[model samples]
Target: MDRPALGDLEAFLAIVSHRSFRKAADELGLSPSSLSHMMRALEKRMGVRLINRTTRSVAPTEAGERLAARLGPALSGLDQALETVDAWRGGPSGTLRINTNEHAARRLLKEIVPTFLSRYPDMALDLVSDGRFIDIVADGFDAGIRLRESVPQDMIAVPFGGTTRFLAIASPSYLERRGVPKVPDDLLGHDCIRLRLPSGKLYRWEFEKHGEEVAIDVPGALMLDHIGLMAEAAAGGLGIAYVHELVAAPFLASGALVAVLSDWCPEIDGLCLFYPGHRHVPAGLKAFIELLREHDRRGKLG
Candidate 1:
């Protein structure tokens, strides 16, 4: 049998991995129409229908699934081999994809990325903000950011920022209507702004003090998925919000929000940069990690 073209194989793999023509096109730096044509050509060459595409989603046929199961690891190995070769000659000259929460991304970009990009002009950085915990390897991310305590035990976690604490805050007007809580349980009587997790459950508010940890399921009139939106709702006097102190600092200083339960707010391990343990760190990730360390040393990360 004649060998399949490398481009066709790559396009096929990308489409199978992302399950979206537009997303695969963006990742491969190809136009959507071009990627579609490439897939059609590959399917014709293989003499089998590979993908089942509907208006809402895409999936692989049984034959395509078998091919993907065999090709996925081979393609991953090829990518690792290329990365290993690039590492030898590198002063950080490739794209680095990272998944993180919005707060962590904002903090890292403020102190680390600007200088690193200036030094390595050829390097590209792609940061995606996601609230849910994700498998970085499955998602094709080089690294991900999460709290130190949240990182998996098998992953290598490096501290990226200083300690953080949660603050219970409310607008003055709301506080006037419903008095401040003296303790965690008092939140049960208040109109709290609850955060909804990606898994479709309310986030439990956590607090620590004097070696005692508490998780409270507070009542609320509003529920939101995004932290920024929750903050905005709190600012609008909708309800009290439990959020990171750093996130509410500006509002607190400006008197738009007033923090309560300060004594219960406890310092906890900060954000961490974590990645798969088995995979070799790419030069781009190494450079970014070093940049973070340097920034930490200088006390620039807050």
Candidate 2:
């Protein structure tokens, strides 16, 4: 049999790697339907079923797995080789995989993404928003953005955001009806809004005062996964929301929510972009780092 075209091989490889046509299509810059059609065409020409597709998941057939086991490393090497050439050429291209949380994604999209995408047309940014502290190397991410405190010490960290704090907030009406808690412990009796972490555990509200720190597992009827929604719930008079001050700022400014226990909110290290220090930095990542630093210097990024 004749060898598959480079594009077809890449399409098949992406599908197998991601285990979802939609996700693979996103990486390959093609619509899922189009990618599906191409896979069909490729399978027809190759005279075998390359992918075993089901509604819930995608996987490679036996022959396809053997092909991928052989081809994956070689294509990766070829890609790395080309990226090295691009480093000398100063035209950063190829995919840049990033793992980050919703907060950082919002900040990047708001402050940096538009300009960065326009400036580096050849570069493809693949941002995955996940709250889990995933192992970037094991998960195949080029880099990860996380709160400085949460970032692994082994990775090289670059400051991407300034120090920020969480605030305990509620609507004026809710506070008026329930009365404001004077201390973190006072939250025990109140209808506090709660947040659930990615690990499926409830987020304990952290507070600090006079060199003493405490965490409270405040009880509440309402719980949410995202900070923005938590703020919105507080604004809607659901309950006291412990969330990032940055996300709650607009609601506070609009008089939709009022902050309390401000003294208890601890100031922590800001968000950091991190990568394994041992590996060679790809040109795309290098370009992004330079751009980020430039923006920070100009006082545009925080």
Candidate 3:
């Protein structure tokens, strides 16, 4: 059998990984039609049908799947080997992809990303906002930001932020009308603003005081997925909202939202930058980690 072109193999792998011709084409800096032409040419050269395409989806043929399984690791190793030179000469120069929640995107990364990009001009960072727990390796992400408790045990983890507390907040008018909760259970009697997790279940508000912890499943007039939206709802007097103190800072300062049940709010382990433990850490990832740790250290000092 004739050897397939390296470019052809790369395009095929990208298409198979994404299951979309358009996405693979975009990644390769080619038009969809161009990618289609390349695939046809590749198929002609190999004399085999490598992919099956429908209007809605694309999938690899059995031969293509087997080929991809073998090619994936080999190509990955080649990429790493190539990057080693860049690391030796350039210090760190590659794209870094991360999956994180909106909260971290807004509260944590927002402040640092610009500086990071300016300082490391060769480093390309892609921050993908996702609320669900994802396997970073499977999804082609370099790392992910999640709360410490939620990070997988087998993964290598680094602290992204200091211990943070949740705050129950509401507008002055809402608190006055609904009566402020003196305790965690008092939320049951008030019009609460609840959070809905990505798994489609309501979030239980957690509180800790005097070494005792409480989880409250309070009824709410509104349920939201984004923390920013929840803060907005509470500011609009929808109900009492459970929010991170970092997210509630501006609203509380503006007097649009007032913190309640502060005594019950627990200072919990904050976000972690986690990645698969088994793989070799990319130089790009090491630079990112160093920046994160520097930011964390500066925050502690300041």
Best by lDDT, which number? Answer: 2
> Which runs in model 2 stand beyond 4 Å of their true positions?
1-84, 87-90
TM-score of each: 0.76, 0.74, 0.79
- Model 1 lDDT per residue over 57-156, tens place: 9788999999988887777687677766654665668789999899888886775878988988889999998767887765678899998988988899
Give per-residue lDDT, candidate 3, residue 133: 83
lDDT of 2 by residue, 40-122 (tens): 98999889999998888788899999988988778878867877777466588878899998888988998678877888888
Ranking by lDDT: 2, 3, 1
lDDT against the true structure, each candidate = 0.85, 0.87, 0.86
Clashes found in each candidate (C-alpha, N, C closer than 3 A):
0, 1, 0
Colliding residue pairs in candidate 3 = none
Name the candidate, 2 or 3, with the larger lDDT value: 2
Candidate 3 clashes: the total is 0
lDDT of each residue in 128-175, candidate 3, tens digit only: 997788867656788999889999999999986788878999999998
Which pairs clash inside model 2?
161-302
